[model samples]
Target: MSGRRGEAGSALVEVTWLAILLLVPLVYVVVGVFEVQRAAFASTAAARAAGRAFVLAADPAEAQQRARAAAAVAMSDQGVDGGAVVIGCRPACLVPGSVVEVQVSYQVPLPFLPDALGRQAPSIRVHAEHTVPYGSFREDRS
Candidate 1:
């Protein structure tokens, strides 16, 4: 009778500790997922900005440069300062129909948690392509 009561208390204590241990790792994984999603969103926005700039450019080389610049600007605006924005142009990225490809990379840190899950932190890459029609502007000479 007394032994059964003591066993119950010990079991409860053990279960409590186990719950805490499992909870920490679960929380860390959730946080890591959230960070990855944020990174993807930032990269996608940068790609879109770059693509828009490229499509409107008159010169292919200039367009590529402009796309890179736009991507950087967009990344900065999105509060992501540690990633690289790469713009690959025609023959490689641009199509005959005024399309551009933008590649964005971001390195994510591992959230604090137990390391038993073997989820190694890795850099994530997001690639996006956008096709834009060139905007027309009338030349003015006085």
Candidate 2:
């Protein structure tokens, strides 16, 4: 009877330890998901701003410059100015009445968890792009 009692206690201890071990990974996954979501929002905003800038630009080169500046402003607003946001032309992309592509990219840092789980913090880079028609109505006109 004593031997059985001892075994039961050991089993409970093992279960508790296992639960604690699992909790770390669970928490990490939840936090990481939220961080990724925040980054996605930032990227989307940057892309939209870039697209708007391009649409307002007078020429291709000016469009590119505007795109970059717009993305920078968006990034700054989102508290992610340190991250990179790139704007590029797609072929003969900036013709009047054509579609202009704006790309926004950034690296998101995942905070470190405990080393007992043998997991290292991860930094993931994400990108978002948007295309807007060149002839769309401008804000100033409205």
Candidate 3:
């Protein structure tokens, strides 16, 4: 009977330790996944906003500037920073019926990671692309 009681106590302790060991990594993974998802959303918003800004601008130079600004705003709104916003035009930029493609890409660092891990800490890449077409009836001074 005494042996049984001791066994129960040790079993409880072992189980607790096991649970803690298992739980920590799970929590880490969940937090990392959430961060990656947030960055993904930020990138998506940046791409869409950039494409719209490009389409609305009067000329190529202004279009590029507006697109970058819009992309930065969108990413910053979600607490993300330093992502690339690239604009590519199809069939000539600013012309009626031209298509502009905006791409936003960034790296999301994993949670609970240390810089000592490497110069490039473990990270997830969040990327998004959006396309906006210049309105067929849209005419502006350039």
Largest lDDT belongs to which candidate? 3
Task: Please write out the lDDT profile of model 1 over residues 1-142, one tens digit for every residue.
Answer: 8768757668788999999999988987888788777777777888888888877666667777888888888777767675776665444434443334567777755555344569665544544444454423422111
lDDT (tens digit, per residue) of candidate 3 on 1-142: 8768757668788999999999999998888888999899999999999998888887889889999999999999999987988889888888777788999999998877788746867788888999888877878434
Candidate 1 minimal-lDDT segment of 10 residues: 133-142
lDDT of each: 0.66, 0.74, 0.87
Estimate the overall C-alpha local distance difference test score of candidate 3: 0.87
| Cα RMSD, each candidate | 5.6, 5.4, 1.7
TM-score of 3: 0.90
Residue 51 error, candidate 3, Å: 0.7
Worst 10 residues of 2 by lDDT: 133-142
**TM-score attained by model 1:** 0.64
Once fitted onto the true fold, the runs of candidate 3 whose alpha carbons sit more than 4 angstroms away are 140-142
Residue pair clashes in candidate 1: none
Candidate 2: tens digits of C-alpha lDDT, residues 11-117: 88899999999998999899888877778888898899888887777776777788888887787786775556565544455554456677777878775644446
Ranking by lDDT: 3, 2, 1
* Model 2 TM-score (2 dp): 0.65
Better of 2 and 3 by TM-score: 3
